[model samples]
Target: MAVPGMMRAVEIKAPGGPEMLVETTVPVPVPGQGEVLIEVAAAGVNRPDVLQRQGRYPPPAGASPLPGLEVAGTIAAVGPGVDPGAVGRRVCSLVAGGGYAEYALADHAQCMPLPPGLAMEEAAALPETLMTVWHNLFERAYVASGDHVLIHGGTSGIGTMAISLCRLFGITSIVTCGSDGKCRAALDWGAGHAINYRDEDFVEAVKRITGGAGVDAVLDMVGGDYLPRNLQCLAEDGRHVSIAVLGGAKAEILIPQIMTRRLTLTGSTLRPRTSAFKALLVDEIMRTAWLFVAEGTLRPAMDRIFPLAQAADAHSRMEAGEHVGKIVLKVR
Candidate 1:
């Protein structure tokens, strides 16, 4: 990588709409201590990017405010006290922010090696969805083999990732989606069951699928309207993890029911995690799940790719809820 004074990025001039994402040449960031500079080949579009553009989500301190949370590329430079050999190694990283740029900075510890045979687009899409699924299914919800799990948004990036993960781990996945197409698609990818949520009561459907026993865990992205129903679908001692609030933020859960069921409601955002904690998770996934990628047991499903300049189109597709899998931007 030659010294370039500036690099191309989609800068958010003001938070309002997708049109606010404007192309600009910003100063190329130099990796700081414990950081790595990644020559971003592609970046993944996620919900937080839309929220950031709407003035809802703000980046953490010392982070780039521009949207995009995950990126794949070759390491271009390593910070002081880091191994220089990391430069030029292929990687896809979970980033706090700044992923929309041609170059993005990541904690070296959070960098994930690109699995052999994974395309650049697929690699870029890995970080955000995989991190969310791993945290919710394994850590918070304690999903185990033979456990019945319900996931909302069955065809979106998180949904698709969850479907793949459940299949690989021997858990039974019952997913809910809005349309028949996505429902069938989820089933094809190893979802044990798919419910057309618009036409079916997910609570009743889960009970029927699990032989009236209900589900052991739930991964919910829709919060407001679906809260009570999620509780109803949970089996005794079940864990429900809410990762997003697409349905609305505030909702009520019956206290007595929760106590009787011994259900645990938990959630977390990946970007806010400490570097060491994320490093540990990365190590854990590498040890337990990397073989899936190596053996082709797991795959990153990509919905579409757009040139970096067409970020608005990418965001528009995601916002319209039309993408079946992850949307990626080729940053080059």
Candidate 2:
């Protein structure tokens, strides 16, 4: 297993669009203490990557400024304090940045062994959405068995994973998608109900589906005008977790409703969190979600795979909003 001195990576030449992503050769990154160098087999293309490329989201300080957030690969080397034996293991990791290369470095604490039979591409899709869902739904909202939850963007990678994970844990999810086909896909992924936001109002649909009561929790990515509606769609003491501001960042919230309902509104961005925080999530996933993955109960929904050099094309597909699941790069 000879590691190359220089490797090809997709770099953002300037903040703009997909075309800004260019393939370039650079010296391979060296893993620091508690990190491992991964020979990337695949990298998951995420919305944050798109935002980063557009200059809307920048990598956190001390992080690799590359676009990719997650990767699945074999370890090429391990830094001090990490087990040397980890060098040859197949793993999927949640990285702060730097996954869009042939070789990338990840904190060992953020890495998890690949599930028994999952493919590298599928494994690559697990880290970002999985950790996001787990942190927001289970940890923050404290979603429990039999609780009803609402997930926005139900066909996106996070949406699909939330639906499946909700089902796995005995929670019911009502999801909103942009089309009839996407709605059907969400339902098939185990959502209790799917609302086509294009055809129907999600707040009304949630009320109807819940028998005039409302969901116990909501996983929201569309922040703007949907905020007040999300409030209306929640039961007393319910939780609303916002992960993204896809619609718009500014929102006029109804304070009275929040006060009357005793609701909890919170949100988090994953990249800026300390390594210790992510490590806690990794431990939890290994103990719970990993078992489901290993048993073939939880599977990553893959929409498309593109070659490493076609990174721009992959981003284009994601931006076009036709993809129903995770998009990945076959890095090899």
Task: Say which candidate scores most in TM-score.
Answer: 2
lDDT (tens digit, per residue) of candidate 1 on 87-198? 8899988998999999999999898888678888888998889888998899999898989999999999999999998988899999998899989988987899999988
Q: What would the per-residue lDDT of candidate 2 be over residues 1-332, giving only the tens digit for each residue?
A: 68889999999999999999999998999988999999999999999999999999999989988889999999999889899988789999999998999999999999999866899999999999999999999999999999999999999999999998999999999999999999889888788899999899889999999998999999999999999899999999999999999999999987988898899999899999999999998999999888998888898889999999999999999999999999999998
**Reference-based TM-score, model 1:** 0.98
Q: If scored against the real structure, what TM-score would every candidate get?
A: 0.98, 0.99
Please identify model 2 stretches exceeding 4 Å from their true place.
none
Q: Residue 183 CA error for candidate 1 (Å)?
A: 0.6
lDDT of 2 at 85: 88
